[model samples]
Target chain A: MFENLLTWLDSPQTLQAIVVTGSLLLFGIGFYGLLAYTRIIKILISLSIMESALFVFFLGLASDPHKTAPILGDLFKNFEKMNDPVPQAAILTAIVISLATMSLGISFAIEYYKRTGKNDIAQMDALGEKR
Target chain B: MTGFITLFTLLSMSVVALFSLRQSNLTQSVVLFSGVGLGSVVLFFIFNAPDVALTEAVIGSGITAVVLLIGIRHMHKEPEIEEVMMENRRGIRRIAIALLVLLTLLLLGKTLLGALSVETSNAGQALLEHAMQAGAANAVTSVVTYFRGFDTLGEVAVLFLAATGVGLLLTVEKGEDAIYIEPNFILRIGSGFLFPLILLFGLYIIVHGHLSPGGGFQGGVVIAAAFLLLFLTRRRFGLSHKIVTILESGAGMAYVLLGLTGLWLMGLFLGNFLPHPAEKIGMLVSGGIIPIIYILIGIKVGSEISYVVEKLIKRSHDV
Candidate 1:
């Protein structure tokens, strides 16, 4: 039973479990920060962390022990042994899109900072009932 | 060994993330954020996605750090003051958060385990099988440029929108009493010497993308990094908005036209319209319109990102 547990600990499935759980934990950390932090920049930073966690999870989901990089390099002769290109491709798009979103968010945050010297969400009441 | 490395990287990533949040200093938080980006790049590399690794390394750590730092510098150095206390989360809220976390972990574990039991998706398998026909050695490149070209087009549009939005935000009013600092002598001299070489390397990555693990976006970001280096070192150096817009929009137009050309020649948009000799698989000139689109992507991304960086930097120097 100890040997079985050790083998399981060393297995790729165990690695996958670690990655998934760790990434989800990272996401949870970001969510907690989102709830706790009032600074707009901190909130944006938390958002970026959440995005990174999601990326990690997607990459982890696509990982396989038997497969290699999806490149037809000399070392990887067989196409069948290649890793899934879809997730990598999708991730490339996601990374770029997320960068865009983050930059836009940062810009909005800075703009808000500029208009009112407050970066705290709790303190911001820009759209009040008064005109 | 790979498992151990993955575990270590993720562990460090989590630690850094926790520290980044715990710190009240905005600059330190931004620096730790770069650590998170570095960890992700390592994670991508370990996961056998070299192309994504390169992109993440270049954009995530390189450009993203600089952009975030610029934003931080634009504002005062005051650490954020938090009114909410952890002590405020009494019995009910703490229990709710704990339950939510447990449910999330359970759901994630079940879903990932189920996914692991299945084979790769059919579309992914199909792309891998037909990758050779695209005359590309990198299956990711083929998937990105040819198989899902429309998605790439949309990504470019999104980037365009981001640039526009950043421009609008940064240009709201003239930066009042903004001051610019001149870079040190060593940085100026080093950047001057390394500028051309970095530019050359970026181009090599863009052109060799079809044959290797890089493509347009990664290469373009490298080029933008080079420009950013120049911007940092030289106070007088300024990106001409006219030229940048022309190059950026021109690359976008070229990408669309190339896709339209493929559609005109072949039945589908972004099809392999150029002749693909079997022997040209790993050559620089191989991959038909894939390399072409990649070059365009590299140029467009490079121009737009650099323009964004320039706008952010110039806003700091505005009188």
Candidate 2:
């Protein structure tokens, strides 16, 4: 049973599952931090963790076991059709949007730091109370 | 086969997750973050989106890391990390986000459930069959141009919006610049070689867009990346700002003008007014307006991205 499990783990299908599993783990940590963590910056990091995990999960779902890069040439010549390019297009769009998000997130971090000199959500709340 | 892997994967993933979750420090969490990015990059490849995988590899791993590192460095100085022990966690917010996501997924799934196969898809089969007539070798390119040029035009609008918004927000705020701008020998050397290489590749991607997988957006981003290399190297590369602005506006203006000109010449807006003679698919002059549109998109995207980054950096003087 142990040997079977190890062998299975080595397979691409298993590898993909493992990837999603890691992503889920990330999502959990991020979700917990986003909710329970008291620091604003830490929460942001947690959110990022969650974001990356979801990214992995989505990408993993897009992969096919016997597929190759959707490029044209010798490999593609033998194939009936290339794998769906829609996911690639969609993910490419997502990547760009994520950059914008990060840029905006960091900007907010800077602003938050400037205003509070503290990056904690709890501390931020105290300041909010002060105001 | 898939079931066993899925089960095992879930098990292994939980172990990794537990490790990350049990970790006491914020720094460890961030380090673990990259692991997730790498895992996803692999998944993207599996999904047959090498283009997406490449983008994820570059931006998700590269630029995202840079942003996070900067954020973390600043965050370390603050005592806020230890101060939070709130009674109420944002469970409500989480539920709301989840519900919204579920709704979106359900809607999307429903929409796709009844979708036609590629063979029966009107746009897909038409482009595949009549691609030669459209002057585009690639069916995708044919669809993008003759069928969906309007969407490409809208994408240009979005790029312009990003540039404009960032430009307006920054307004060339004064601050110490050179001290803030990170520089390195490798960045200089690699950038020097890489920019032109990337630019060359972008042109190839755009020019040959009709024949292959790449298109205006991908090629345009590459061109912007080339410009980014200059920004990293030259610090004050004095990027002929006016020329870039002109190019950006000109490309967009030209697209509209091209469309309007078609209306004048062919008595229809965006009409194939000057459609190049569709002699042979995949040839230089083939794909009539596809190549021209791509070229315009490359210019527009390159300029807009550069403009956005420049605006965000605030053009502060070195202290």
Candidate 3:
């Protein structure tokens, strides 16, 4: 049993499995936050957490233990044994785009708070029937 | 050895994410959220994605946390007391919902891990094979600027729209009160000493993008960070909105014009038209149009984010 566990730990797939489980748990945490929190900032934070989980999952899965980074340098002469560059590039774009959206959401929340004097989403009843 | 490190980082990240969400204090939560970003940076490095790691360190960990804290500063502090009260009154239904979500996610993750093979796709392999033809040493940079250039253009457009939206939403009239905090003497002196170095480092990252790990987006965020430091440290300092707008617009137009030039010259949008001799690969000046495009992107992203930051802080309105 100990030998079996050792073999499992040595395999590259072990890292991938850990990443998958961890990111899923992180996503769940974000989901819980989104459902439990009423503040706009908290919701935004939850959304960003969800996004980060997805980014981690994507990059972690695409990575290979045997290969080096895709940059051809003095040490790495070519792309023969390099991790996939496409996902990294795509995730890079996604990170910037997510930052843009997060900031935009924050700006909207700030404006809403300034106008309504309320920061909680549950309290945003400006269009509802008067109490 | 790497496996153990990865396991530890992931575990810590999970803990940090949980704590950040559970924390009642808004400021503490924001700081803990940045800790999560820090953990991801380490994970990205371990995963052999140095480019993505750099970008995350700059934009995800650094700028996003700053933006969140500034956003918190913009709001009145009294609402948080009500938030704390709401936290206490959370019903059992919320816990039940959270448990349900957790169970569903676990099931989904299990199925996903089983179905997805641990290998690169055929498309990715093909990109890797031809990535060198773009004349950049960093395959990710080549893929981002040369192969998937159109998507990046659209991304820049999205950032522009977001920045414009923030500006519109947060535009303070002349009579409106602006946020002003007394500058710390230490921070003021330190930022003055650090500003030029940060700008220089941002330029190095942007310029060396084709030969190294960083590129326009990461370098751009670093540049904006320098401006952020100025905003935080210096009391009456504000960016000239007109100048920033001009710089952003000009850089964006130049990017498109470069693409048009590629199309006109080689019949492919963003095609590498300049001479990029294969022997010269890995050299700083070897990537021809790739480095130029990255430089333009760096400028555009830097100016756009700076503009957004200025709008968020309401400092430019006075200027």
Highest-TM-score candidate? 3
Candidates sorted by lDDT, best first: 3, 1, 2
| Candidate 2 CAPRI level | acceptable
- On lDDT, the candidate that comes out on top is 3
Highest DockQ scorer: 3
lDDT of 2 by residue, B252-278 (tens): 999888778767987866666665665
Candidate 3 lDDT tens digits, B8-108: 88789889988998888888999999998999999999899999999999988989998898888877555635654355447743775667667756655
List the candidate 2 regions with Cα displacement exceeding 4 Å. Answer: A1-30, A38-80, A115-118, A125-131, B1-35, B70-76, B83-85, B90-146, B177-195, B233-235, B259-279, B314-319
lDDT of 3 at B236: 72
lDDT of 3: 0.84
Candidate 2 lDDT, tens digit per residue, A40-92?
A: 55566566667766766665555554555444443433223544433444456
How high is the lDDT of residue B107 in model 3?
59
**Model 1: per-residue lDDT, tens digit, A14-129?**
77777777888888878776777767777888888888999998887787756788887667554777788999999998888877777777777777777777666666779883
Task: List residue ranges in candidate 1 displaced over 4 A.
Answer: A1-7, A129-131, B77-97, B104-123, B172-179, B316-319
Candidates in order have lDDT scores of 0.80, 0.59, 0.84
TM-score of 1: 0.91
Measured against the true structure, the TM-scores of the candidates, in listed sequence, are 0.91, 0.69, 0.93
**Regions more than 4 Å wrong, model 3:** A1-7, A129-131, B84-121, B175-177, B315-318
